[model samples]
Target: MIQLKSLQRVNPRDVEAPKKFYVQAVGAGKTDLDRLAYLISNQSTVRKPDCYAVLEALLHNMMDELREGRIIELGNIGNFQIGVSSDAVDTEEEVTSNLVRKAKISFRPAKALRDLLQTVNYKKVS
Candidate 1:
C-alpha cells in the first residue's frame, strides 16, 4: 500500500490562481540492499549473502554500462539509460561538452511494472 499526503501548490501557468490541494505519494522510507537481499532470499532458495553480492555486482556493472552509453535492461523490470541536461548553444559551432549541465540516469518501466500500478492500493495521510 502507498501513503499519500495532501499538499498545496500554486499553478505556474496562472500566478493569480488560488493554490489547490494535490495528492502526492509519500515514501515510507527506504529499503537498502541488505533488506532487499533478505526479502529475496525468503522468496527463493538463494542465500541472503549471495543475493547481496549479486545485487552489489549488478550496481557496479550497471554504472559501467551506462557510462559506456549502453542501456541496462532488466527483463521484466525496466531499462536504464544515461541522459544529459545541457544549455542550448546559439550556433552549432558554439556547442561543446562544457555546455552539458549534468548527466542523469533515466529509467523506463516495462509493461509488467506499468500493469502493477493498476493494482496499487493507497491511503491518504495527514
Candidate 2:
C-alpha cells in the first residue's frame, strides 16, 4: 500500500479560520536498476546480467533520440520528450537556444498507467 502523511501550512493568511490539512505521499522505499533487473530475471527467461545490459543501452539510446528531437513512446508506459523553460522574448526572432534557462524531460503516462494509478491503494502514515 502507498503511505501518505498529513501536511499543513505553517502560516495561514486567514487568521480567523481553522487550520486545514492535506495528504502527501510518503515513499516506502527506493528501487535501483540492479534490483529491477533481478526482479525481471525472476519473472522472465532473461538473465539478470543481460537484463541490466539491455536496460543500460536502452537508456543511452533514449537519451540520444530525445537529443535528436524525437518523442519516444514506450509501449503501454509513456511518451518521453525534452522540454525547455526559456526567458520571455518580445519577437519570434529573439527566441534562441541561449534563452533557455532549463531543460527537462517530460513524460505523459499511457492509458494503462493512468488507469492503474486510479486503482492503487493508499494508507495514512501514522
Candidate 3:
C-alpha cells in the first residue's frame, strides 16, 4: 500500500497559470536490512544472521564490480551502472577524466518491478 498527499503546484512551463492540486507519493516509513533479513528468515530455512551476512557480502561484491566499470544485474530487481556528467570540451584531446563533473549509479528497474507497481493500492491523505 502507498500513501499519497495532495498539493498545489505551479506549472513550470506556464508560471502565470493558477496552481492546481496534484497527488504525489508520501513516505509510509522504511524497512532496513535487519528487518528484511528477519522477514526472509521467516519465509525460508535460512537464519537471520546468515541472511544478513549474505546481504552484506552482496553489497560489498556489487560495489567492487561496479567500481570496475561493470553493470550489476540482480535478476528481477534491476540493473545498476555508473553514469557520469562531464564538462564539454572543444577538442577531443581535451576530454579526459578531469572533465567528469560527477559520477552516479543509475538503476533501471526490471519488468517484474514495473509490473508490481500496477498492483499497488493507495490511500489519499491530507
Candidate 4:
C-alpha cells in the first residue's frame, strides 16, 4: 500500500471571513475568484502560478454566463445549469413547471483526471 501526505484541515474563521469580504466588499457574487484565492491561499505555501490567474478568469467568465441563465459546459467536465427548487406537486398527472429563480452551479470532473486518479498509486511509505 502507498501513503500520500495527509491533507491539512482548514479553520472556519479563515474560510468564512474571506467569503464575507468577497460578497460584501468586492460585490462579485458569493463564489468568485477572491473567495477561491482565499481558499487556495490557505492550502498551499508557494502561490505565484500564472495558471491560477487564467483559471480565475475562466471561472469568472463561466460565472457571468451562469448569471445570465445560460448553461456553461467545459470540455471534459459536465455541464453547469443554474436553477431553483419548485414547490412539491400534489397531482397524479405529470406536469412540467418552472420554478428556477437563482443560479446553482454543478461540476463533473474530467475523464482524464478521473482515469489518472483511478490508476495511479502513491509511493510506498517506509
lDDT of the candidates, in the order given: 0.96, 0.92, 0.95, 0.60
**Model 1, range 1-126, lDDT digits (tens) per residue?**
999999999999997999998999999999999999999999999999999999999999998999899999999999999999999978999999999999989999999999999999999988
- Tens digit per residue, CA lDDT, model 2, 1-126: 899999975446777777678889998999988998999999999999999998899899999999999999998999999999989999999988999999999999999999998898999987
Residue-level lDDT for 63 in candidate 1 = 88
Rank the models by lDDT, top first: 1, 3, 2, 4
Candidate with maximal lDDT: 1
Q: Candidate 2: minimum summed lDDT over ten consecutive residues — where?
A: 9-18
Lowest lDDT block of 10, candidate 3: 28-37
lDDT of 3 by residue, 16-105 (tens): 999999999999889988998999999999999999999989999999999999999999999999999999999998999999999999
Model 4: pairs clashing at backbone N, Cα or C within 3 Å: none
Query: RMSD, model 2, all Cα superposed?
Result: 2.4
Higher-TM-score candidate of 1 and 2:
1
Give TM-scores for every candidate, taking all chains together and pairing residue i with residue i: 0.93, 0.89, 0.91, 0.40
Model 3 / residue 7 / CA error / Å: 2.0
> What lDDT would candidate 2 get against the real structure?
0.92
Evaluated at residue 60, the lDDT of candidate 4 is 87
lDDT of 2 at 38: 97
Model 4 lDDT tens row, 18-41: 332111112223675655666676
